[model samples]
Every structure is written in structure tokens, then in C-alpha cells.
Target: MSLVGSNPTLSATVRWLRVHWGTGSQVKNRTIKWLLGLAWVTAGLYFADKGATYYRQGRTLPPSVINTIPEMPPHRAGDRVLVFAPHPDDEALGCAGVIQQAVQAGAQVWVVYMTSGDGFRLAVERQFRQSHPSPELHIQFGKMRQQEARRAMRLLGLADWRILFLGYPDRGLYPLWSSNWTPSNALRSYYTDTDTNPYRDTLHPGVTYCGQNVLRDVEQVLRRTVPTHVYVTHPADDHPDHAATALFVMSALARLRMQGIGFAQRVVLRHYMVHCGDWPQPQGLHEDEPLTPPPAFFNIGLHWVKLNLTPPQQVRKMNAIKAHTSQMLMMSRFLQSFVRQNELFIEQPVVLPIEASLGVVWEEPDEEDILRNLQAPGDFSAAELRMENGQAVFHINTRSKPRPGFSYSCTVHALLPNGDVTTTLLRTKPGRQSADARVDEDGVTFRLPALPSGSVLVLQAQSRFAGLAVDKTIGHVVRLP
Candidate 1:
């Protein structure tokens, strides 16, 4: 009887051990499988996001009048051409074909690089594989980029002396224009760690990085070069520096004309864009293909000029673009996208005449302007402009209902007939207010005093939604009764 009891106990203990070991092994296997699944999910999400960006970039061009516009004719002999680049490589990227054509026609070509463009953090990182680089390192990178620009222009047949580097801060030009309008209040360079021009061989060494100084240098260049045709960055470009550079050039021209500078009257303005949203589609080398304008700009009322390249001209442009080794090393695809068989430009913005008798005119903001008005990943629609007697109103409409406890605000300004400017700020009510107050459920309206005789109207609109604020500023010239 004792032997039989001992055997039964031993058998039970053995069975318990087997069950425990089997369960532990199975749990271990399941945990490993779960971890593998999670890793795959994370990787899938990452690649999906990258693929979506490239997919958006590959979108096709819509049918539009851009296709019907005539290609730019070849340059006439002795054509004095001036190309203004906000950054080093922009001259090669946007105007390579034109540069080659001008050189072949024996036209005098001058290339002006507004900034060394050393502030592109990603480009710096990619070039040096350094994370958290210091400001001094950025200046070094800027120097390298300047050298690259020189080589690129030389490859395009431009003489060394013809290329001028203004050595302004790469990314600070817009801020300088917006706030630091004087030499005493110059905007400091975030990359160069200095507030004044520091690069060698600049047009004006030691010039402060301010609107006053930038305009002064631009005007000086215009007066000295007396270019018959001038090419600059587009006004609606998404890049702040690019847009500001164009504005500075335009403002300088206006200032010169206002002062009765004779040469300003003869210069023709052409604008090019390099920083638009997914423009110049098929974002790689599409040899023999034509470069077309973005569909969003179809009705913006600007005339586009196209320059078709000869076979050799296209090849030379590609070679010149390739000469931007630092940029090509990182964004080769984007750089090559501009080496197509044609280039494009738009005539400078002309003052849109607002009929005095009509009393009111509604102007819709560009899609880019609407996109910029969003603070987060949200939807926004049109920002409509209305002008009337003694009042200018801005109505910003949103497609998506804003989050709870949200409101809107705007600033209205009048460019008075006598060149004086005035501004008023308006905040929408929380739950609705007076009609004259111009508050509505779908959007907010901001009313300003009537524009002065021969004055212009400007609107700076903002939205407060769930701790996020969206803002955009726009302006237009107005006609007075």
C-alpha cells in the first residue's frame, strides 16, 4: 500500500512540471511574435508616409492655358539680362536655360545671389552628416555653397566677374522686411552669428541685414547695371525669403520710379518660382519635357512667359545644375526637375484697378494663401476681400467647423493716397454680435475705414481655433472716386 501511494504522488508531480514548462514556452513564443508584428507596423507606417509624399509630387499637370502660351523667343543681341537669386543655387535651378541662351546670343548676363543660403539645416546635415550643428558650422557651410554657386555659373558660361554675391542672411530676408526696416535695427543672422554682411566679395560688405540696407543695395545694382530685362523670384512663392526677395526688388523699382529714376522706366520684370507646392511636376529629370505653371495659378491674372530650350541649351542647363554639387548631392531629383526643355516666368504684378463706381469688389485669395492660414492639419477655404465707400472688409470662410471655444481675428490697413499707412485690429465675438460688427457663424468680417484717395487696402487675417492660430496677409491697390 505504501509503494502504491508514492508512485501516484510522483506521477502527479511529473505532470505538473510538464504543464508549467509548456505554458511558459508558449507565452515566450507569443511575445516574440507580437513584437515582430509591432515593428512591422511601425515600419509600414513610415514608408507609407514617404511614399505618399512622392506620390503627391508625381501628380499630373491639369489642362490649362499654360500649354497654349507661346514659348519665349531667343534673346536679342546685347540684351542686358539680370537674374536675381534669393539663394546660391536658385540662379542655376530657375534660370540656367536662359543664362545659356543669353551667353550664346552674346547678351550681357549678370547673376546676383541675394544670400549664401547656408541656413538650410537639412542640407547642411546631409552635406556633413552632423546633427545639432553650431552657428559657426552653418557659416562654413554657407561659404561652401557660395563656392558651389560660382562654379555652377561658370559652367553656364557666365564670367566670374559677372556673378555678384550680396551675402545677406539666407533665411532672415523676410523678417528683415517685415520688422527690421532700418539699419539701427538690423536683423541678426542665425547662421552666420552676425547682424551685418560678413562674406567676402559681396556687393556691399558690412551692410546691415535690414530692409533699408537690402533695398539700398538692390537699387544700387539696378542703377549700375541698368538691365534691360530683370528676372526675380515670384511673389506668391511659399518660401518666405524668395517672396521677400521679389518684394524687395519690386519695392525698389517702385521707389526708383517714384523718385524719377530714368533707368527704372525701361526695365522689364520677370518672376520665377522654385519653392511652390509640388510644382514642376514629375519631379525628376524629364528630358525634352516642357515646364508648365501650376494649375492653382491658372486664373491669378498674371501673364506667363515660356522659354523653350534648344537641344544643346537643355544639355548645358543640366550640366550647370549638376555643377551645384552640394545641392545635387542631397536633392538631385528636385534639382534635375528644372533641366527640362523649357523654363517659365510671369510678368511682375501690376496694380489691379478697382472701379470707383462699382463701390465694392470681391477678390478671392490664392489657394496657397488659404493653405498658409491653417495652424494645424485642418481645412480652410476662401478668404474673400470686399471694398466699399469708407470701408474695406475681409471675410474669411472655413470649410470645417472649428473646434469648440474658438474665435477669429483680423487686421485691416489702408495705404493712404499720400503714402501714409494705417491699421486696425478686429476680434470676432465668442457667440455672435452686431451685423455692422461683421461677425457671422461661418466666418468673421473685419471692417476698416474707407481707403484714402488712390490708396490701397491690405488685410492680415487670423483664426483662433482650439489653441491654434492661422494667419495670412494680403494687399491690393485701390482706385478712389
Candidate 2:
């Protein structure tokens, strides 16, 4: 079992068995069978160790984290709350406690579902027991998810009219933000069988499935509701939809601020993490356990807070999450892990106040400390972001130079103040990995649209060698001087 890998004694036994039975001179049928069994055990051990390390490190929060358990804010009589979810069940999983508390305090609350959550193909297939289902069936699945969200929110004491759905394409928000900015080339939702918003219940029913439209819709919601506290997904979430939805929310808030109507520094921006890789360790029903943020985030420049729940509140939260029957059927145990004694949230400022510059600026010693220990020397060395010739230039320095016939890609996203983003996607081998797909490999330089003041740049570089991703890095950089 993979659990054996987490224990040194068990893992050692498995390793010893592998060495004794595998790579031997005898090639008998029984020998082969023993070798196969040993191989499986070895693999299980490897994965178990990985999972163990992840959870162990997460529980050991960094020393620099002050206010590790800050006072949970008491709800005001007329407090307004908004929760933005990339999917339906996420709201209940991450913010059910907050919602219940706010409603109990007579605070107005609104829950916005960004997508129909129709992209969960595995759950749908499992539910239908079909390898392939019709597009109409997929739409029906989306509708089911919507109903599940309604039931979940209702359990949290939210009125049906207070829940809003944007009806965007599930799992395709990042692409819509990256390439499909115009109505003509809007990202089509294969599941819903509509290119633009088709749900009559959506905030903007006819809005096109694009980044700008999503931003506008979010802005409209903010302006209409004027919530005092806005809760959205973390930007570093592993899910593309979760990350992009956060970006969209920030963009909308930025535009509203620019127009002198946005919440700006007045409203509280609380972030909840629903999707991260192997987080909230010991995933199962542990209602008495306390939930903590992953260790990687302690020094990541966000102030985290925990909402301690009463026994009754925890039970209510658990019941609300279970209301999402569509998702619960697929991953009930994983869902129950969130119904712990407390919920974690972070307060992050959305503004990046960088001064406008007319000339090039550079920051040296660009190696990211986080990656230094995680990656090899030749994987990724340094990164630089500079403004030159009216454009934002990004250089990702990699020590492991790309070889001929290999594939390399540089993905860059620039977050601007006006809620608009410019992305540059470059690849050495396009379409095919033939020899002709080679290119100059001195380093990867991406040219993005000129970044205005108050912007931040995020860069990711990866390389594929011999059909394997041998090197990759999420680069870091200092702001323009």
C-alpha cells in the first residue's frame, strides 16, 4: 500500500524485497511474478512518501507567519458579503461557514457561480456509466450542478434569488482570457452547446464568453450589490478556472476603482483556497481537526486568518456541503475534509502601485529561493522583467539549454491596472516536434504589450526533451526600479 511508503520501516522492507527479488539472474515465472509484485510495492512506497512529505511540511507553517491565528471578524448587523466560486460546490466547500455566520448575523450575502461546472467529465461519466455522452446530456449535467449549488446555498440560509450564475464555459476560462478576447472568436462551451452565455438565469445572459465580458459582469455585480467584503479564489490555485476567475475579479475591482466607484481600499478582499495540489492533509472526515493553509503560502506575502467554528456551525457547514449531491457522489470523502473545526482565509491587497517608467529597469540575482532547492541548477537560473522600447520584455534564463529537436515554451501573463491582461505564448516546436521546429536557444525572451504603471508580471518556462518535461520553473522578479 502507498501508506507503507510514509513509514520508514515498511518502505525499507519493500525496498529490500525489490532488491532481493528484482534484477536477479534467475528468470523463472515465479521470479518474474515476484519482481512484478516488488515493482508495484516500490511505486506505492514512492507515492506514499511524496504525499506524506507534502502534508508534514504543510502542517509545519513557516516561522515568519505572524497572526497565524488572528481574531475572526465579528459580523456587523448590516454587513454585506460576496463569495465568488469557480464552480458550484466550491462555495460550500470553502465558504459555507462564513456564509452561515453572515446570514445568522442578519448580514446580506450573495453567492456567484462563475461556471456551470460541466467540465467534470469523470464525474459525469461515472454518474451515467457511459464512456461517451451526448452534448445535450452534458448540458443537463451543468443544469444539475446549478441545482446542486442552489440546494447547497439554501442549506446555508441563502435565498434562491441571491445566488448568481455567470454560465461561462467550465475549464476554459484561462483560454478565453488568453486568446478569445473578441466576440467573433469567443470560447465555445461544448458542454452547454453555446458560445456565449445561454442560461437565462445568468447575470448577463447574452454576454460573450470572453475575459472582458466576464470582467464586466463581475463589475456589474459589485456595483449592484456594493458588498463590503469580497471573497474570491486564490491566484496561485492549481485549477486554471480558479486562478483566472481570481484574475477576472481583480480586474473588475480595478476598473471599478479607476471609475471612482470600486471598493478599492474600502472593501475587504478575502481569498479562500479550494483547489491546490495535495493540500489540507489527511483528506477525509475529520470534523474535529483544524484546517490550515499549505506551508508554501506562509512566506508568499498574504496575511492569513482562521475562522474557528462552533460544533453546531461545523455541523451546519458539513450539511451545506453535502447538499451538493452531484459533486458529493464523486468525491464525498475529499469534500468532508473541509468540514473541520475552522476555515482558513487570506487578506490580500489587489493593487500593485508601480510608478510609470519611460526607460528600461532591471533587477539582478533573479534566482527564486523557493525553486532553488526544488529544482536542479540547470533547470532555471534567473529571470528578468524590464520595460524597453515601449514594451515589457521578459527573459527567462535557463542553464539547461535546449537541444536541437527538443521543445521549449515560454508562457507570460502581464496583469495591468485597467483590468486587462496581455499574454505572450511562444514555443520552439509548434504543431510537430520535427527537426525543422528548432529555434535559437540562447535564452527565452518574451515580448509582451507595454505594461502600464501598477502592473505585475508572472512568467513560466518549460522544456520537453525526449517526450518528457525534464525542466521547468515558475520565475520570480523584482519590480521596475
- How high is the CA lDDT of each candidate model? 0.69, 0.68
Model 2: residues >4 Å from true position, as ranges?
Answer: 1-67, 355-447, 451-481
**What is the per-residue lDDT of model 1 for residues 244-299, given as tens digits with 9 covering 90 to 100?**
78767776665565456776767788888887666678789988677878655655
Q: Compare the candidates by TM-score and give the number of the best one.
A: 1
TM-score (all chains, Cα) for each model: 0.74, 0.73
Provide the lowest-lDDT 10-residue window in model 1: 1-10
TM-score, structure 2 vs. true: 0.73
**Could you give candidate 2's per-residue lDDT for residues 181-277 as a string of tens digits?**
6677788775555787767777787788887677678888888889899998876666768867776787667556655674554888888887654
> What TM-score does structure 1 among the candidates reach?
0.74
